[model samples]
Target: MVKSHRKDSVDAMKNAAEILAVDSEIISRERNKIEQAKYNLNQLNNLLDDSIDDEIDFLEQLENSLKNPGDFKNSLLLEKLEIIGSRQIPNLEGISLIDSMEISYDWKEAVRLNQEYAKAYQIDLKHPFIAMFSSIELVEISKQVVEEFELLELDKLDYAFAASAGLIAGFIDAIFVGSIKSRADATGLQKSVDKAFDKIVELYGKHERIAELTNQQEKAKTDSSKQNIQNSIDKVKAGIVSASKNGKIVEREWTKHDSIKWLEKYKKVGYDAATNLKDGSFHIPGMSPDNHHLLSLAHEPSLFGLLIGIVDQITGKSTFIGNDGMIQRIVTDNVNKELSGNMVTQITQACENWFGHIMSDIAGSSGSKGRGSGLPVPGWAALQKLQFGHINYSERHSDVTIAELSELMFKKGYDVRSFSAQLIPVLVYETLLRCYWFYKQHFYYGKDLKESVPIANNRELARLLLISAGSFSTVDVTHAIIKSVPGSPQFIAEFIMTVNLPGLVDLGFRSFQNIRNEVSHRKHMENIYENDILIEYNRVMSDPSVL
Candidate 1:
């Protein structure tokens, strides 16, 4: 019986071993199938990626072809492309936004200034002279205008007149040099330039009419010229907006009626919605630097002087009597009769250089904040003031000191008056953020403070820090910090813990509200109340510890 049981056990063991081997083989086959599936999936993914890339490349080429200036129309091509896009391609709005974001700062500014220019002159950007002058050219004209006003020793009040005069002169000169080749000879481009010039002149004439109506001290002729100068700037702004807005839209062959209908549609819908597809700040992302030292180096008032000098050198003497004075002759050369060399190329080069200068300026003036308060300081000067207390943090600042800081913060730091209304809020917010950093660092973090400064970039971090310490109501914290002076150790502690970070931030930004409002509305400097806000700001910024 024992011998029979042993034989059965051996047979059972043999069957079990065979069953385990079969199971192992089945598992191996399944693993192979899984590996093959993954490989196939990866291969399919790569193929899809390649196909998408090819489609995008083809689309890019088509877009470029559509923008070409000649009379060729591709109605069938556009239709075919649209059909293919609708069938196979993804929505390109995000892609276009990314492309806009990636554009150079100079390009962005040029677009913005073009919009302003267009709206000011009530002209389209496609008009020849308007097309010629990009963002950099506007900066050059602005610089020239300011310099000319300085040379005239005009009262600072008359600087606006100088600027306007300078702009008209510059535009007319650019048109002449750009379009007229030699005496009595005109390039094919000349017609567009002439048309643009006539339009500008007509617009300028309107200012004379307005001046007559208002009965201002300036003569109608002078006022018209001055008004034309402003109109030129407005044209630049408008041109920028128009270009950026229309740049991506595939140009289709349009009948006169089609064009009129398109304009009517835009009028009804409003151009603002179409043009301002993104936040309207004239900021170029990749060009700007967060570091103060780097920013200063980056933006260093590039090429404005060089371009001016070059234009001056190449320009031949020819003067035309202008509205304000024969002074318009200073900027406008008689390219129709005089001036030599490739004036077109020279003007082009000048525009390019000016664009570079504007980029550098944008880099220095505005950028993402970094360490050291996570707020933009007015370059190295403000940094110095922050680090070493060169401007005495506790005491009342001298007029000179205040002026310096004001220039640094308002003029160089923010480019307050130069930008579009859409960008005012952005500039104002940034300025306030910087001010908040200054307030916190001086009062909360400096040696006088009883508690350590709360490190925060946004308001939520501030709230979190307060809530973690103890129970507190938002209302109590806001009242203690803003409505009344910050005092009493317990109240200070609570205020430190519970103050409305957003409100405080808003208050800091509020200092620039008046200036922003004035600039946004295109109000004159005389209308701006210099003392009211500045005085309050000075008191608040002098020392937040007292508050």
Candidate 2:
């Protein structure tokens, strides 16, 4: 069985008084110092059976009591020590003098303890005295006292090892400046050294209590604040974990076996325009008609409901603006990590630079320069919004054929061609955006275990993807929400008008008018042209660089 260090240490203290009477000069002349030593060793052996808590208790006492100048003086050992002139402590038994002391513990294990100590006592670890302590110093001093008392047979020990004694010895040796160590050691010759050290600590403890130990008043305030921050982070992470665990989002695979069934679903849905697509761009040709274009045209099978379950983690306010406009404005409260205008613009640009040409080229008006103007679509929407809009338009939303998207605005009648071309893609794009906006609401940072779910996968690898995806997704959605507004359509519309589909400027504008019309008419679902929509939607999903 493993021995208990605490029990052994406590037992050693029981016999310390008896060993104090010996004379140092004639070790044999003393009253059986060997016998006294035997008793002390046996006590240590007995103490070993005690529990770890007891050991720690003994250690605390040992640390304090040993410093008392009169601790050993009260016993026979003091008489023995009194007879000898001042001399350097020597090795004892197999243990060196310095090795007997207890300075500090292991760094890995003690870091938390040390941090607590520092916070509670304002103690600085970088101080040299603290650094020298970790185990060697403690052992060293114990060996020294033993050797000085001739308690152990030291002729077998090495001087090199003796030099590595506990930190307390160094403090005892006047190494530390006008600190407690020097004063205690100086007074130790006449007074009880251990008591002096304890008194000094007790006195200091009083002051430390006033500063940190009590923690009465502001704790309520700090606790409330910390709770608020933690709760927010927890709520977000929980949502992500919950979604990943049970997501309605599914990705399907289209293989040879499914093709027989595929023809039943979509045989004529070739790689035509995105107008061939429906709400989810699934190519619902029979139900939606032939006017729409397929924004996402692939032989593959996959559909993800929750784009990434980690977007809500960041700071933002989720608000329902209208029937179709649910938006979140991400903002950071970090005072230390402020992003400069140039930095914000750069990051925003990097996030949405794809829309650079469209933004610069599409904006109907050059906004005022004082408020971040000269940029495209500068109605509070950054290049990120433009890129996001550009990319989103290309991907799941992009179902309209270029030709159909071309005819969307100028066409006088919402005919069969317009219905097939415009309504389908618009439905697809709008649905995806609405779904994405809804999904981003549940992200959390895993702050509170009770509120936020912990990251359960491979931490380093998986977290990176999650973080990137979350950030980019938020950036993209923010843009879509901002630019989708009618006033801002000219913001990017006029720019796009110069390039490919100038009519989209009108269509983008018309989408807003349609929204109002639907609201006034209380339309069950707002009507739209699918074919004309996917051009912008598919561009986003296909471009790896966009999102």
Candidate 3:
């Protein structure tokens, strides 16, 4: 009997060791995930900067090439022959620089995709930052072309092409800039920013708070107390600095709203016959039929969406207007890292503002001396109406499921009901809270063991869970709840808040607070479900107003 008992003890010891190893591995993996996310954030910034530099270089080269067209064409032809002689296509081996037409196609597509995704994501300007800069580069290139070759005695076709390129670039730039600024001004972040004004009020308030802190600092006789005072002061100083910086960024962004003035002096110079392929032969060798279609559609400003669709096909990317537009490319080698939670929120907010400003700048008309009186430039107000129309389209078209409804309850703010796409994190938080509360009430607080559902054979674990429930980390509380209810309910009805049960509803309210804490701190859900718990959630919060 003793020998048998000793053998059982040895097996238990081995099992415990294995469990420890598994836990250690999990911790290591999480740490690596966090580190990788940080690495990706840094790499994204560096990559954007690098891509912008390359784009600038290409524009400079293109400008130079246009100045000496004969030499440039001869060199390109020679290079092409050399590659063909070697039995290798020019673009077969590696990434190659896209030509002017290709760039134009890509820029349009990027803008189109950006508009489509931005609405879906409840944010503005979803395109990659580097991609947006393509408009700026195109405009710069066109300006250079116009400056150098506008006066030169060139062939009719060549001069028309060059002049058209400049005029087209100018018009497109105005559209891009206008779109960006409108989007930025209409962000949900402005709600958060309203608190900045409140903060300013607090800072200017009489120093009862400051006096209390100063008194505490003077009375601090111990190392810990002195350290505490220094920390408090540092926090105060940091908040002030952050408020000041944020104010400056806001000012800079809004001042560009005046960019719409660019439209007031807009013009489309050159021959009206230049728009047609038959009347004016402006065909470059690499340009396709789809490219011509895109250009043809550019005559009407309202058909920009249709233009984007045609251009998107040729560019093999998304497009904005009917003309084939090209954007800068992003190198994604080091960007595979998982994003940190804070980084995700920052990216969401910053991209909206960044893209908004860019689109605004693009659409902003320049007050140039050579303004053509061909077509009317769409002003910032018109662009804003377009954006509002898109937003309404998204809201109306979005399909709301039980899962989406449930998820909506746990978002960082109660205002999430306004945007259907912003519902997931809130849903996960609600699940965590409900699960924790149910586990606590039935498993911990309940007296009758048989009446309550059976869980792990541990009492101290319940105590620890209760204590941890009060912790700042919702994830920890969630884990504790999951552990306590080993046989957790699969359906939302099993745990969702009910109208008649005031006591149960109160518990839900407390849990909801916990969820809010987690979201505000950028804590996120590990796993996602689309239609499962949400069905259960819908059964309980049947009232739309309650959600």
Candidate 4:
């Protein structure tokens, strides 16, 4: 009886061991699957690139048309493309808002300005002069017409002008073309929107495992880390919401209503729903140490002069992140551009030297938080998160000090900004997402071309930092511009958070560049192409600066 009992116990132990083995095998299989999926994605990308090259070869035949400038538009292939374009084009209504808005706004402004003038120059309603004009009913009617136009909304000011002007011209010259409030532009708008996030996620993917974002994540198991990130995101969401109603929509009392009761009717609204990737999950790209390394170097006071000198060399030491009164792409396309050998080597060598010191210094990124009040100093070693972009932590900040630093760095951080500027243009097309896709933050104000860098063959020292999509369209940018001004489109920011009007503005500006390129290349282009693209890019990429 004792022997039989012992056998039963041994069998049970063996069964338990088998179950454990099966579980391990299952996990291994899932990991392999994920790896294969990643590999397949790379393979597809390579295939797609090869296809693009083939298409370029085919396009070479079309370049023949470039020789004939006037006859170029008559090209068979080009006409076919236009036919395709016309088919995809949106309806007239999409453009009606644009034309109407323009006409109405101009009319209102003209009327309003005229009314102000009349009040100063012609109004005598209260006195005998009023009787004089009023007795001449025809003149009074004309004045009444002007007064009516003046009462339109500020935005409608242009609409009124265009309508009136068109009427004067017999409606021949005042038809508006560009459309606002377009659902058709959604795709482009989303792309414009995605650019900011792409940048931020790109930053995180490259630096997710770095010391700055996820030092804690690295220590935990992957599954555990995922949970922690999710929890942190939830906390962040709550914090952002709780911080203020600034980002939310709510009703408050109006000045005319009972001041305390005004809150009942005057409600504010949150921003438009944020767009996400195809997958519902917020994608935190791969982890990297790029920013942890770059910012760490930038904080160095010792190299401040060299940094400035480098930026000056490449970006004219423009004394600021801008040059030529515009901000150009900091990153130069050295491969295509004819950069002299000396300049390229000097810039590259400088970067290597700078990177080396920042990564290896005695105090390095791990230095005491004493100077920064226990928070990771602006530039320090950190476990960077791959999904969310920039490093996030709370600490005391003296505006005066930051301002002083900005002023000092603006003057002396040329090399840093020069090389760093490269990151900004690249950043402009990036998406803002740090952690996973859930919490997005990124720079909203797209920099304008302050100065022109050599289009080809230039050198500069710069650094790349993580950005967030959330930050790109947040309250700090054009929304602030709108709020600061009355009846400005920026005011629409009061309603939309996900959409950055500044970004739209930039898009319009880029269209202008394309127009220039088309003209330079002698490509048969639309007469309105340049202006249209300019407006379109601005409609998407405009920074608050434009306002």
Candidate 5:
């Protein structure tokens, strides 16, 4: 049965290949006939022009003879008249002949034929090997072709709707979801971030060891003295540990002071201006204990951070941007020392420790007074390293780099929680544009709901998004300008707070990509025709008939 089924499959493929070859040959021959007919028509038109000119010349000679009665010849007059009468008039019949010879392959007709052929052979057109042969194309669809055909063209009304939606969204961004100052801000976005942080902290409480620290934190809240509170926080920090699958406890050595004491044998190498420069401990410059979560890449609350933190723990090294705007690596005294178990066991412990440490740092440290330093936004640390653009705030704070400005922003409470708040306005902009696009596609254009979902390789949707984002950015930039006027006393603060860095960066990148795509569109279309359509055509034409 298996052998019979295989043979049948082979036979089906062979029949399909033969059909494709015949079809290809027919198409090629018809195309050649059309080309030859066009050449013949041109030649015929040229001959007709010459014949008309000859008839005109003959008539002129006969008129001259009639004027001179003495020189007039009866035979010459008859010959001129005969020539005029024999000339054929230009007619539509020649055009009709060419039109009749022309070959046109409609996509619907092709599809119908494909279905009939597949049914006859009992072949599933969806089968991977048979799918390519199921459909044929005379012209492959490409971005340039789509544009040239005006398939995704937007009318005046579409432009108006997109712009209006963008304007409305921009206003929403500027009014309701203004600059993020702190996690506890009264904005709706900030409230959402606070809820997320609470959820994370709640999950952290599930761990047995972390739950004990939470209990200690509650007990310390009742104490009035600052000293007692500090001691309780330190005790909690020291008690944090990660347990492996086999129940082996591994202390977070790089972060915890007690574990650092065990690694006093290895020499610490590298400068850390943020901490004590003289101390023989691993440190990253500009990464103070208060702001390390923002400056240290390993302390970020992301998978990237987790991976980097694990590497740092096992290798006993810290990575951060130096004061000179360069990436700096520090070798701590914990290098070449095993914390617990084998290499894999140590890695697992490191991962767990990293997660627990980030959770603890994300909301704030145990000793924080109000809104302590939280983790920086994911990928925010990398952005902070771009130390370009010198701006003078005042005589005292002149020539401050972008990196320094970002640090100051973090100090003023623009942490990961605050970054989440900033996303609300961007979200509003995107949502409004998509909704407007969908409405136009469905109701205005008379398209089905599924087709009008504003998804997939949709050029019109992409164009609309670009325009909307531009409008939104314009309003945002205007707002930033109004809030942070040059020479104002609060210029720096207002500028950093008002300007949506992530949104602006995104818009800039998209604008650049759109421009690039437009410039290369013609080349892209040519490549598609040659590499995809022409190649497939040639393959069908040249491939040996399996039959």
Candidate 6:
């Protein structure tokens, strides 16, 4: 019985070993099948990738052909060759297939295809959103679109009309807008300045001071004797000095020779630098009492000048343009004591002082006889520092620099009010150009009134303005030449009065800007054209469908 049990166990163990071997064989076969399947799948994937790449290349060629119609025939021929080469035989069937393919470039079909492609690829070709973020700029694409559509399409007739209008306007400007000789002879502009000066004085509660000066003037007029007039002038000067003094600080006594004593304590802090023009104490080169307002940067009627003037008042320093056309600073030796306030309060006080001082200087001082050297136009001082060019004022002084000419202009009453008078011609030219542009665009071109509005940025309108301004400036130049003859008695007067220097400067600046803009625009357009195909490819590739 023991031997039989052992035999059964041995047989059972052998059967188990055989069963394990069979299972191992089956598992090895299954693993080999999986490996083979994976290899086949990889091969299929590679074939699909190559096909997709070929298709993409073909699509790119097609897109290029669409962009450049001139190359369409050559591109289509190449595509035909490719298709025929891919075929097993270059026989009649393949030739017929190539022949059957549409070769003609049809705009309607092209547009339809583009629309379908855009729709499928979830793109709007008309208003393409090429960026994932707003900051990502497609400058080339934008330029391409603008070049394709936003062209200025004005005709010869339009330009003719613009020129005619400008000529008429120029004539009007020469006749109506002459020169301002004095405040009393000033156009509406001087009256406006007077009213503003009066209002500013009233607002600052300095009317009493002005009233007293007026009273002094009235008394002087009543008594025309030279001695009596001198007395009244001396009293007026004394009153102005007394009124201008800051009582909070110790006063510095000035002599009768000090002409600018009225400005001794004008700002509570120090502002006056030169007591008189004859003395070398005035630091600014070529500065005179008549043209000091133009030479001194601190006295400029601008916010930047105001700030500089305030600093001068606080620090007891005077800032002016040097002989070398650079800024120079010097100690004033005028501040009697330190101002009593925090920085903010001091600044506020400085502003008040600046306004009051400007009012006193804007008109004339009580001692002034004529138009009184008023404040220059805001940027007029800058021209004085540009001491280039030579003008023959007279045979005695044959070579006067442009800087001297600027000063002469100021001395001859070319103040801010005069600058305003100069604008009339410019305004007339602009108005005429705009009206003609609108009339032509609306009536002849049949454009809407809104579209016909002559906005500055409109290329057509800008071109018209440039041409018109040129014509107007030409007439102004002619007027100046006709009026100002060399060696004539009226040469100085006519030269300064008739020549619209400001208008000429404005024209030159605008012309430069226009040319620069046109050049830049052309460069951008060229760049867009150079990379048009690449830009389109990139845009198409970015589409979700292409990905």
TM-score of each: 0.16, 0.15, 0.14, 0.17, 0.54, 0.54
lDDT for 300 in candidate 1 is 24
Give lDDT for model 5.
0.63
lDDT (tens digit, per residue) of candidate 4 on 177-210: 1111221222322323323333332233223222
Off by over 4 Å in 1: 1-340, 364-402, 408-547
Clashing pairs in 6: none
lDDT tens digits, residues 464-503, model 3? 2222222312332233344334344422222221111222
As a TM-score, model 2 comes out at 0.15
Q: Which stretches of candidate 5 lie over 4 Å from their true place?
A: 1-151, 182-188, 206-280, 333-339, 383-388, 436-453, 525-547
Worst 10 residues of 5 by lDDT: 263-272
The true-versus-predicted C-alpha distance at residue 403 of model 3, in Å, is: 23
Q: How many backbone clashes does candidate 3 have?
A: 44
lDDT of each: 0.34, 0.29, 0.33, 0.31, 0.63, 0.61
Candidate 6 residue 370 Cα shift, in angstroms, is 3.1
- Model 5 per-residue lDDT tens digits across residues 227-262: 554554464455543435557755442222222222
Candidate 6 stretches greater than 4 Å from native: 1-149, 156-161, 180-269, 273-280, 322-326, 333-340, 431-455, 486-493, 533-547
Higher-TM-score candidate among 3 and 4?
4
Encode model 1's per-residue lDDT on 1-547: one tens digit a residue: 9679656545433433333333343354456666766766776677678677757766666676678736435764566566555654332211111101122245346445444544553443333333344467768876775544322222442333323332332233233222112112333333333233334433333333233334432444676676765554354333321222445734232222222222222222111111222453422221122222222221223343334334433563212111111122133232222223487875665444333223222322112221011112223222222322133212233232432332233222222111111122223323433344445556654734323233433232232222221121233243445533444333332333223333334334443453354354344332232444345445643664732
Q: Write model 2 residue lDDT over 86-160, tens digit each, in one string.
A: 333333333212111122445334444434544454433443332334357558866774544323232312222
**Candidate 4 TM-score to native:** 0.17
* Residue 523 displacement in candidate 3 (angstroms): 35
Scored against the true structure, residue 166 in model 1 reaches a CA lDDT of 27
Clashing residue pair totals per candidate (backbone < 3 A): 25, 115, 44, 131, 0, 0
